[model samples]
Target: MPASPREEDVLTARELYRFYRAGEEETLALRGVSLRVRRGETVAVVGPSGSGKSTLLGCLAGLDEPSGGEVRVDGVRISHRPETERARLRALHIGVLLQTRNLLPHLSVRDNVRLPQRAAGRKPVTSARELLAQVGLGERMDALPRQLSGGELARAGLAVSLANSPAVLLADEPTGELDGETERMVLAMLRDRAAQGCAVLIVTHSAEVVRSADRVIALEDGRTTAATAPAGGAVPAEVSDATG
Candidate 1:
C-alpha cells in the first residue's frame, strides 16, 4: 500500500527502489528509501558519490521511475505513470534543478525559463522575465547558456526550474560548482523560495546546504536514516546579487 502523506506534505516518496540490468548483471541503486518534505520546509539528502542521491532526486522529480514504491507531488501519484503524464505532473507541481544546469545550449535564458511555463500549458502566474530578475539575471535574459559565467548559469537554471511556481522543488547538487560566496547567494534564494511555502528537497554533498536545511536525511548503501532532528528556526536572509 502507498504511504499516506500528511496534509502538510507537498512531496512524498515511499519504499522506493531502483534496479539497473546490464545484460546478465543487475545493480541496485536504491533500496526502499522513503522521505517526506512538507510545505515551507527544506530537507537535504546527503551521501557520498555512488550513494544514490542523484537517483533519488531523479525519481522524486519523476524524471526516472522507481522499480518499487511511489512518489507523490501535491497528493498526486507521479510514479508508474506514462511518460507524458509524468512530464505533465512534473511541470505542474515540481521544479527540478539538474546538476548540469537545466538549460538548452541554443536557447536564450529567457526562453529556457519560458519552456517550463509553456510545458505546463497554462498562463504563468509569474513571468519568466520576473523570475530571471529575481535571480539577478535580468540583464542576461537574452544570453545563451554558453555566454554566462558559472554563477550566472546557476541562477538562470534556478529561474527556469521555478518557471511554474511549483509546489515542490527538487535540486541535485544545486551549488556544486560555485565559489563559497556564490553558493551562499544561491542557497539564500532557495531559502527564500522555501519561505514562500515551496517544499524544497536538495540532494547535495555540501555541508553548508545540510546546515541550512530544517532536517537532514542521510543515504548510504541505498537506504535512508534521519541524520539530524529538525532544527526549526528563522528562515535565512534574502538573496543578494551574484553576477559572477
Candidate 2:
C-alpha cells in the first residue's frame, strides 16, 4: 500500500483542502496544500492573517478534518479517523502548543508535564524535572500554573507539551508572548528538540523563527506562496540558550 509513508517523515499532508459550510455558504480555508516534515528537521509555516495557517496546522495535527486530503504521522494515516483514535495517536506521537497554553491550573508544573504520558498509560520518554530544566523551568516544577509569569507559563506549557516526547512537535506562535530574551531561549529549546530528532513544525509570523528553520513554507489566500527546502536533508545541530 504505497509502502505506507516513510517513518522518517514525522508529519505529512497531501493535497489538503478544507472548507467551512453554513447554510449553503462556504469559506475555503485551505486549498490543495501538501508538505512533509522529516525527522530532526524544522519547518516554518508563515503567512498573514486568514492565510489558513492555523487550519492547516489543525489538519496536520489531526485536530480537524479536511474536506479533502489526508494527513499522516510516522507512516500512519490519521485523517478522517475517529476523534478518540486521533486523540490516542496525538498522545503517542504528536506534541502541540497552540496559542492558549495547554496547562492544567490545578496541577503543579512537574505534574502538568507528566499528565500526558500518565493519561496514555505510558512512561514519559524524559523525566519531568529534566524536561523542565531543558526549558528553563527546573525550579518552577513545584509551582502551580497560576504562580508562573507569562514567560514562565509559556515555558511550563512547553514542558508539558514535550511530556510524551512526541515525534512531531507542532507549535503555534510559541514565542508570541515572550520578551526578546525569553523568545530567544524558547527558540533555542525548539532547535535543540530538532537536533534530538523531533520533527518540529512551527506556525509563526516571526522573522526570527523563519530564519532559524531549515525550510520555509509560505501561504497566501489558502494556497502555497513558497516552499524552500533541500530534499531528504537532515537539519543541523544548534546550541541551546536556555541557561538563565
lDDT of each: 0.86, 0.82
Most lDDT-accurate candidate: 1
lDDT of 1 by residue, 138-241 (tens): 89999999999988998998998899999999998888778898889889999999999999998877767766898888788788844564365322221112
Query: CA lDDT of 93 in candidate 1?
Result: 95
lDDT of 1 at 74: 88
Q: Please give, for residues 140-183, the per-residue lDDT of candidate 2 as tens digits.
A: 88999889898888888788778888999999888766777777
* Model 1 TM-score on a 0 to 1 scale: 0.92
* Deviation in Å, model 2, residue 1 alpha carbon: 20
